[model samples]
Target chain A: MDEIRIFAPATVANLSCGFDVLGCCLDTVGDEMLIKKNDLGEVRITKLTGQDLPLETDQNVAGVAAKSLLGELGSKQGFDIEIYKKIKAGSGIGSSAASSAGVVFAINKLVGEPFSPEQLIPFAMEGERLASGNAHADNVAPALLGGFSLVKSYDPLEVISLPSPAELRMVVLHPLIEIKTKDSRSIIKQNVSLKKAISQWGNLGAFVSALYTEDYALLGRSLQDEVVEPIRSILIPYFDDLKQVAMDKGALGFGISGSGPSVFALCKGNDIAQNVKTAINEFYKAKAIDFELHLSEINTEGIKILE
Target chain B: MDEIRIFAPATVANLSCGFDVLGCCLDTVGDEMLIKKNDLGEVRITKLTGQDLPLETDQNVAGVAAKSLLGELGSKQGFDIEIYKKIKAGSGIGSSAASSAGVVFAINKLVGEPFSPEQLIPFAMEGERLASGNAHADNVAPALLGGFSLVKSYDPLEVISLPSPAELRMVVLHPLIEIKTKDSRSIIKQNVSLKKAISQWGNLGAFVSALYTEDYALLGRSLQDEVVEPIRSILIPYFDDLKQVAMDKGALGFGISGSGPSVFALCKGNDIAQNVKTAINEFYKAKAIDFELHLSEINTEGIKILE
Candidate 1:
């Protein structure tokens, strides 16, 4: 009861239509973390490996997220944290979100489950704030609650967990390039035409319905981003060519994951996902860029307990 | 198969968050029309009553809609149409849509149903274009397909029918004053802040999810229109006062029905709907404005047959 080990998965945000609101968890790509209760009555990051991240309790994403939860309760109960990082920093696949969500999730269990998974979102968001100056729930939410999560509102912090279809799979490609969320976001215009805004919401609304009805084709048709993608996609290398090949290879939909450097192609089945992965791999291999490819099912369970 | 009488239902569009793409059908408030086959080899509005309207096939909404369907099929089949209009035009409750949707639905039946209710949407939309300069399908799609319908795309014209909750009710108040859709639309800014657009799509996506799960409270929370409501609500008299009273009376959510002059209060059940309606009636009466209030259930069956 004093110690716990878990898997903290990566996530894909801005799923084409629902910008800054929709995200999903990945099953196979994540980081492993260990948490142990300390009698010293102090929150500490005792071990950090595989990634050169801040070790200070006040500077680290996971450290800050853990302190936020403990500080809110005024409980001096402390813990020693260890993060075996696998997901790289600034790959745009919610790298910092996994660390933040994993630490809070682990600490909450050690304290006898004081809050529900939904309640853990804000605490995990503190990590996101430390990592990227903005406390966005799109990544940490799905990494906590799993499946598809929609941040309906931010002022009240309402996050709704959506149903995931069994056949859904994601083919993710990270080009080993870093795209800072802030720098990428700067290129986007502050104002958008009302006409395009209407189209965005129409596609997003249809996308939500497609989830409930399990209509894969409808989901694909609804996966359109006329507003943000046109502006932000320019930052990524060969973004347009990658999207075209993904769609031509039978991906249900394709878009820049989070702010970019990492892109995901949503597919109906593993067969199509593999085909898309291979096609993308072959297409990007000629670019002479160092990159990695990941194929994962929709992670229904967000953070998992390890043996 | 020579003669047919039918009831065409009214519809409420722009359900707050979904400005141009969402609408639902009303059960009790609509118009009745009668059509009889003729050997004149031309579409005609043989009789006109209840309200002043053009009888010419080119000028009339119903006649234009009917001709559009016939012309598309290259059919010379003629029909004598009698219009018994009950819905007042320019009230923003889809009055023109009822007549246009009604006539096309009846004619399709008379001609042995050459197209389904969904396929009849474009033909019904001709009536909308005749009534207004723009050919929007929010109202007509619901009146033809029944229940709640989302206009997912306008280019390829993909219309999706959404599930309606059993306890849902709508309280519609038409304040007699007319606000032209064109004029009302002009008040809305051509561009909106990206933050506001994100909020809008987030709420709309949640609203679609609420409809599927029948979560009434969530539906109420999701009925927010930050962009259009602030600009367009100014045209309606005592707009803020009426919305306040409806919410105070336990209405689920309230907003402008279409363009203006007409507003709708969404409530959970019949009792709440009636309470909201009565409160709105009393509030409007004090403003020295003539208004009509209607309480209606979500109409699952759009156009109905009559003896």
Candidate 2:
């Protein structure tokens, strides 16, 4: 096929105690990209929709990722790309990751799947570097591979897919405020006490075990970020109150999504997820903040083809 | 029965990346305790063997743990305790944990198990405090609960048992040099950079997942210790060379056990475990250091009754 369309899911990185290592995909909020071969042999962003993002090939994450993949294949074959973005940029929900991963995924398919999903990570990470200064794969890995992912090492780029409980559901609340990724990251302290580091790793280890055993209570208890959240949460409005409200309304756990302006809570069932969403909405209303809420199950199939 | 004998297995704490949070039990080396009920309402250490340890009840870890359990149970009954220490002190193999946990296990049995294994953690921790100033439970938790364990929190004391693969074996080598727990702990820097902490937590999350999923290769890769080992390994002789030799000899992973002097390597099967042990022994012999080596499977049973 000379043309293909693919959907890449939004991802939640950091995952409380996991910091830069853990992430999972969301089923509903994502970006769709359509790719068609061009005779000019130049990769270009022909059209865009839903959000105002850069259309320049070098400036856009999707274009950059697609160009990187084509360069790896050593093909002069160019492609015209169209991005239909649903995940909002600066929402801390991996909007850029969806664009980057979605394009590489579609292009890989257009070339008869010369590279595996794992091989596409570096190209996608290059796109992430364009969006943010750092080449982090936490968001892109889950967006490309699906379910939950652990970026075990970034130096050699090792990513591992973790088991996600079938009953797990996520409630995401996006406040209509922008928090730049660079500013969000700059607020964090460069050093932490050794004692606190130990505590964080303990929770991280327990969290991974809980995922494997499907122990909901253990998972909830392990959703603590003693190191990062304490510093970064100050930048987000009503962060503490929102989390407390969600917890009181039966969210298993709650925390900021990625950097800020967006927050998420994990619940075991659809009913509790709905309750959490309502609770978050009520909190937002009382504070007089415009917001959007989305309830979704863990996206097991990350990126998919659409005719 | 008015009298009982119990054996608490040795443990390897800090398991590389996990530092104050993770530990696993070793099968063969342990401390055995014998407790006999007496009419006098006072706990006493009656006899000792195998090692020169404190005989005063209040100063000893076993005596301290037994007293704590009795206090919790509010029992007026007294006991005469006999200690047979097989695990060497200051060897970085949870010697104090074996002693502390063994007495609690025997005393609980004598009183018809007034506390579940997990409930005995606080008492064992009390014993550990008598050994080390800090009431750290990494070693004690694994000794009390068996197999691999994660101490998720210490304030309220939450400990969770992680699954261990059936084929997992450990080769522990004690180089016969004493690295005092206080000295071993003091060498570590009080503060760690956020970047290093993130790396350590990443490995820890992957390591826990590896344990549950039984991914041996992943487990090996995740055994990296960027935070603690770099500092503590300086105290151990030939630490780097020994680890390289172990890895070259087909061992899955190698790192300092707890602090220093004692180092352990993880291997997949019995043959590889034997090879690792032999390789460590040859390395020690060439260095002209007195050492002891033990090959063991992961102790599924932490503390056991002796008939």
Candidate 3:
């Protein structure tokens, strides 16, 4: 039985009003899943490292994603799955998605890559559903396909690639606290005002336009969120303080990452990005919150096989 | 006093959910306003002709726009304003905007074109505000600049030019009826569901991405309206039937123009454009509703001086 090792990048989804549609990959944070085929005809959860995780292979997100792929292949060969935890679980940095994406990507290659990325997204989303009870592709997409991605539809999933500017940089801060995706999604009101919705749509239009045209100024202006951020912001401690600090130091815009506890700031040049990282660090120091900051370029290359 | 003739093209504002953010110019339907500076301190409305217009220039939309521009310039020199209305009023073709836009475009030219197209939009919008209580720049910006324009901000108006696809074609049909912008806006709900707003944002994002990448398929799919069109569509005659016919005839998509009575369909090819036009004309014919159809490429040249 041959052995395979795969790496999947972490992602920030929801991107403020872009809820299920917009997402981008981050290079620094992700997970590594290693798989080896065996003749036992039984999937085994061999080892779990980094943060404490589920031991049962069936209950494991990465294992489930791998199992789904293997089931599709109808292979009699069993496999041993091992996950090296890199992105912290429940940090809103796509911790679970890394596992799912890494496993799926590795297994697809093992099975001769029968499923396209689009075809694999739903299976990956099922992994997300196992973790959050909601099938969301925002995290899974960027994890699978590097750079900026748009999930046009999720029912029968469709993924579209968006233009990524070379100079784009991201400053993300994860405050040590847990905010479940399901709970965060529940706190938001089911309905919104039409006037506000229009404003959000306008901003989103500008955001997409900026991305395509590579207009930095317009991108900064368009990164505003009048719809979801205002509601979900209350869940994060010192969100306002951290955001203000980041913006004051040259961040273009800052918003909750996925369903928060983690926050990301879009920055212009490296100078601004470094400044934003420092500002966030200072705020966390003052607040006495356990937080980590990462200065990352847009991950144009999503998942890759390390070995 | 120099006598000059200027023509401002008709415009479509609120292109989908862009409400106040997106606007575009149309080549054919327009209004021509002639301005002559006079020694008198009082501005006088001189003549009005074409397309069933008000004889009284002071009460006319063109006069109001011209007056606003004069006020902005602090032009103490009184002017004689003559309007040749080519576009019909209340056709959802931005008739008043053409007059208002023409007044500003001509006044700027008459006074040496001091203000840029960006500067003229606000002055034109002031004129638009007089007719419709809402101060929206969708119509005026397109009339002044031509092609597709995005309004980033309104308080201190900021407008940006968006890329226009070469093969893009617009088919506009004016259904003979009166639907005021205010009335059309009023019919929509004050608020929307957050879930629905997310859907709208997703579509808007896809639409904007499509515009930048020139992806016609994404553009067609993204042209959906979950909030505004469903409610306001009732006001237009045979709105559903027209849309069905137009889409079946090869329109990429169709939607109510501005505040309706007029409907516009987007198509990629000229054959589809003609087919859409014929389909719309047939629908109106069956309903015994008098209508006019215009098949135009996106007008890159906005307001111009007519020799």
Task: Give the TM-score, chain B only, in order for the candidates.
Answer: 0.98, 0.98, 0.94
Candidate 2 contains a number of clashing pairs equal to 0
Note the chain A TM-score of all models in turn. 0.98, 0.98, 0.96
DockQ of the candidate models in sequence = 0.92, 0.91, 0.60
What's the best-to-worst order under DockQ?
1, 2, 3
Tens digit per residue, CA lDDT, model 2, B3-27: 9888878899998988999999999
User: In model 1, how well does chain A match by TM-score?
Assistant: 0.98
Alpha-carbon RMSD, each predicted model: 1.2, 1.1, 2.1
lDDT tens digits by residue: candidate 3, B55-158:
56567676777777778778786778888777778888898888888877877787887898888888788767877787788888888888888776664567
* Model 1, span A1-307: residue lDDT tens: 9999999999999898989999999999999999999999998999989889999999999999999999887889989999999999899899999999999999999999998999999999999998888899999999999999999999888999899999999999999888888888888899999889999999999999999999999989999999999988887889999999999999999998998889999999989999999999999999978898999999999999999
Model 3 score (lDDT) = 0.80
Q: Which residue pairs show backbone clashes in model 1?
A: none
Sort the predicted structures by lDDT, highest score first: 1, 2, 3
True C-alpha contacts between chains kept, each model in order: 0.91, 0.97, 0.67
Q: Rate the local accuracy (lDDT) of all candidates.
A: 0.93, 0.89, 0.80
TM-score of 2: 0.98
lDDT of 3 at B103: 78
